[model samples]
Target: MLRPGSTTAPSTPLIAPLAAPRTARPRRPGLKAAALAGLLALPLLLPATSRAQETTAADASQPTAPAADAGGGETRTEVAEAKTAEARAAIAAAQEEDANDPLEGMNRAIFWFNEGVDTVLLRPAAKVYRTVVPDFAQTGIRNVLWNLRSPLTLANKLLQGDWDGASVATERFLINSTIGLGGLIDVAGDHGLTYEYESFDQTLAVWGVPEGFYLVLPFLGSSTLRDAVGFGVEAYGDPVSRYLSNTHDDWASYTRAGVYAVDLRAQYLDVLDDMKRNSVDYYATMRSLYRQRQNNYIRNGKVDPDQFPSIPDYDSK
Candidate 1:
């Protein structure tokens, strides 16, 4: 084969001129001259034929070279295009999934209701707490009082299963909350602590009240259908209810409701804010969170924030 840049071969074939007309006399001399001429011209002519042969041979050896390379390039291009299309489709699906959450409307309703209750009833009560109490010191005392009351209720609840322990704990809670605080208000006793804690809530559980279906009550926070009613009844039995009636004695109903609203608001502020931010379905979010809390309570008899997702916050830290 010829090298890529070379235009000519080394041997060039020569052409012979026509021999002098064959004559009868002295034809040998003429033949010899013709042979000599043919020999001399053969070099130039041979080179041309050799080059043509080399070109033909090279062409014959690689008939499919260009076609094979072209086909491979096309295949590579098609694969790249397909991969790009697939990636775009995946991104579109993800965006669509994010856009279509089902619980948005319910969540909005709950959010607005909670906001209204907070503004109208709860904030004012907190202000009263601020005014009556001595700075940071009173809040700590109030917290302790609140905590002492919780154990009594918790013991009362546990006692339905282990009645004896409930009886003992109730006595402890009553003695501590009422006498310990010096007759101002036996808050724990108002909830129905006899010598021990006793209440309709504990009574119902003792009588085997099945926990009804869980329901989200927007401003009121989490409760089962049955427990919600239980809460209402229990609220009337509160020590503060008696205090408001006997001491303040004027618009006692309104004052008691305001206090209840304040306490409720303070308890749920962090978790409620979280649901507003993280959940697309506000009702479902609340339901799920409440259920989760209940399950933990059943298991360990306490609320642990670790089990729940963090509520949304401005800083989100």
Candidate 2:
């Protein structure tokens, strides 16, 4: 009820508002204490959570560590395999070299004997010849010697079925013997008909003959069994040798052979010296070179440049 003179409103509403009855919520001391404790420990718990996350991250990266280790292991395995292959190759090369030089002891003895002869007699003679002979005279002598061997080269070319080479050799011989005045000048070479040396050994090689074992002749620096046989045939069948033999002038034939040897040696002085200077095993080096040269000859000088030794240009010098 409101008094007419009262300035204050009534404490209770005139009509109760339409609403559901409110339930009282009870206070729990234990739940309040637990919440307060959790709040108090929050700082420490945060660090522990971060530590756990770091541990999980490290565990995730662990698999990749093993992958890296496996990669390293593979690299090591490859290196080991490469080393093994190299060792095997070295052993195989050694065995092959040994097989090629079966008569090493005897060959070395003969090689030393040849070396001795070269050192004592041939080398000095070659030096003297080079000093005394003019370059033009040397060229003339070389031409003459090559011309003398033209017939033999032609025969070998024919035997090897090289018709073109035989024809060139015949033309060179005819031109040089007459126009060049017994081959004192290379008129055929001036006309672009270059001389090509051929041997019975090369012919035999073309015919599929094996070179046989490496041999060191008493006078010859290096040879094979096949080449030694070829040399004997050449000596017996040489036109000049035959003519001299028939004329009963054995001394003249010897003189010719001696001069040929000296001239050949003189031409290769620098080349041989370079080889001897650089070689670890002179005999083995010579053997390898001889085989390479013989192979080159058999192939008619058609070989890889890398496979050939550094032979000096006699004409250029």
Candidate 3:
């Protein structure tokens, strides 16, 4: 017979035992020794068996290594896809910006020149004005300036076929110029005739003139080709400009222009500073903001609410 747990084959029996006469023989001493040895090893074998069973249970309780690897790979793939999508969106936005700004090289050069002027001259003057001028006085000055531009606004409104806007502008101008002490106070605004600023550029936009390549003017800042031409037209046609030209009072025109620039810059001191501090590319940021602001103006504040703060719409009373 083969021994238990042994790999060796049993030897063939030379002769068969007789079935009729079976001899009763004593157990061998070797058999007794083997049985004793088996008893002695039983405790060690039991512990080993128990440890093997525990190992099998632990392996069964956990996820397979291949499955864990697959799950990790899926998560990484999702993250990669998300990053790719974001990159694509950024690329598309950059392309659109490039399309709008075909004159980017020249525009950027002018933009830097304007920035230098603003930083050295305009910004300091604006800071001083903001510091020295009282809030009420600043408001009055702004109102006066806006009121002075009312005629231009009216003309542009009429040109754009906005009769109601034209009427409102006329009423506001007449009411403020007289009762409001030359528009020092917003009397018409209190009476529900809120001011709405209109410009020749805006009229041109309403008239279906496309805004040609973005521009950064010498000292006036952001504009488009159409707007720049419209500005020239407005300047030539302006009553104040024409009167000043006729009277040969160039000094008065220069003074008025200076004050207007200072007041406009003063109003946006904190806003521009914050934008510059937070922006990665200040030029690109300004370009985007300028376009958005122009669009908002053209739409008469009917733009997406999410795109505010690029430029303040003081005319939206």
- Candidate 3 Cα outliers beyond 4 Å, as residue runs: 1-83, 90-95, 304-317
Better of 2 and 3 by lDDT: 3
lDDT by residue (tens digit), candidate 1, 1-317: 56688887745336434674546334356788999999999999998999999999998888688899999999988877776677677666654443332444664576568767766767665666656656455444544445434554654556467666566565655565556563234444455653333444444645778556554467676566566766777666556555666786758567445554565556555666677788886655656666665555444355654444332232311
Q: List the residue pairs that clash in candidate 2.
A: none
Local error of candidate 2 at residue 45 (angstroms): 7.6
| lDDT (Cα, tens digit) per residue for candidate 2, span 73-144 | 999888777766776776666647544778889999999999999999999999999999999999999999
Residue 180, candidate 2: alpha-carbon lDDT: 99
Q: How many collisions between residues are there in candidate 1?
A: 22
Ranking by TM-score: 2, 3, 1
Task: Quote the RMSD, in angstroms, for model 3.
Answer: 13.7
lDDT by candidate, in order shown: 0.59, 0.86, 0.87
Query: Which residue window of length 10 is worst by lDDT in model 3?
Result: 308-317
Report the Cα lDDT for residue 269, model 3. Answer: 95
Off by over 4 Å in 1: 1-111, 119-135, 138-161, 182-208, 216-219, 236-257, 267-271, 298-317
